[model samples]
Target: MSEIVIRTASARQGDIARRAEAMGVDDVFISDLVETFYARVQANETLGPVFEAAIGDEWTPHLHTMKQFWSSIALNAGTYGGRPIPAHHKHLDKIKSEHFSIWLALFAQTLHDIAPSPEAAAFFLERAERIGENFQSILFK
Candidate 1:
């Protein structure tokens, strides 16, 4: 029955959440990752200008949204509801294809520096790589 299916899905989600928590993937970790990664992005010569052009000086809102986005991806918290493709499309003029690689490198570095465990770092990196690949495929096509 549909009711049973729904319950099963919910239970699976709950189990995943518990596993994430056991690996130290919580709001604090997500916030730290976003903040640290964006800091690197802002400092990078390649990524800094592109991001500055798109974001201007309004970084607080963007950081908050990113925190929500990563939390949703890593924890299944269902916090992010924004349309990422449309949001990125608005800045397509500034976002170069190479920038995704730079972004992923910075993200990996951030995870390496701050992640509580190798497992946690891998978890975020796997999702980040997938997202970067998906965005590139969609945006560049």
Candidate 2:
């Protein structure tokens, strides 16, 4: 039974890989990465409350928006249209260097956890780090 279950999971993963190949990335993979990463952020002691307060009951919509954002970034799909700067402006008062560091670390962990390969993870991390830096500079400057 365990072996069968493992094979089933493996087969599902193969499907994800094939789908991801279509877009140069598996959309499901990106979605899972975002979902897992935010779950960590929500559970994180420092980041959780800040996000919870900012997000409140809007997590569903927020997650959808985020997925779109990542899809746009990773696949050049043009899926997201929102301005990230204004969206993050509300948290400017609460965010700090340390918070950005924590955010980057969590993001790195997420990439590590779900990325298809180390190179793939690094690609995502590079973009994430740049984004984080941009946000920090704009918010703190």
Candidate 3:
């Protein structure tokens, strides 16, 4: 029974990857999205300071990790293995609940600017929203 469930889950993830590819999502796209979005984040007055405090002057590693994270989330590539909740929790003193909304807005704008298609934008936005919600639940609790 567990085997059946695992197989079914794997098949579902495969279908999602195929659908994402049909909409023009790939590793390059994920990399571009992460780069563009982080650039926006760094430029924002509100999010910039918080992120700077958390990441300091080293952004390359964070950007790479983010690319892996998005790849795992959107394509089920299973490349990311970081603990995001604890990572966020480490900066709890600086992170505010309102920051999630700002982050989401920036993410949405980035998707609008560079996503290959509307479907692809929606695909990423849906996942981003869910991730934000989950983080809020855990971090705020």
TM-scores of the candidates are: 0.91, 0.82, 0.90
Q: Write the per-residue lDDT of candidate 3 for residues 40-135, one digit (tens) a residue.
A: 999999999999999998899999999999999889889999999999999999999999999999999999999999999999999899999999
Best by TM-score: 1
Once fitted onto the true fold, the runs of candidate 1 whose alpha carbons sit more than 4 angstroms away are 1-10
Candidate 3 clashing pairs, residues 3+ apart or interchain: none
Candidate 1: 10-residue stretch with minimal lDDT: 1-10
Deviation in angstroms for 8 in model 1?
A: 3.8
Ranking by TM-score: 1, 3, 2
Looking at model 1, the pairs that clash are none
Put the candidates in lDDT order, highest first.
3, 1, 2
Model 1 alpha-carbon miss at residue 91, Å: 1.5
Tens digit per residue, CA lDDT, model 1, 1-141: 355444677898899889988889889988988988999999999999999999999999999999999888888888899999889989998998989999999999999999999999999899899999999999999
Q: What would the per-residue lDDT of candidate 2 be over residues 96-125, giving only the tens digit for each residue?
A: 678999999999988887788876788789
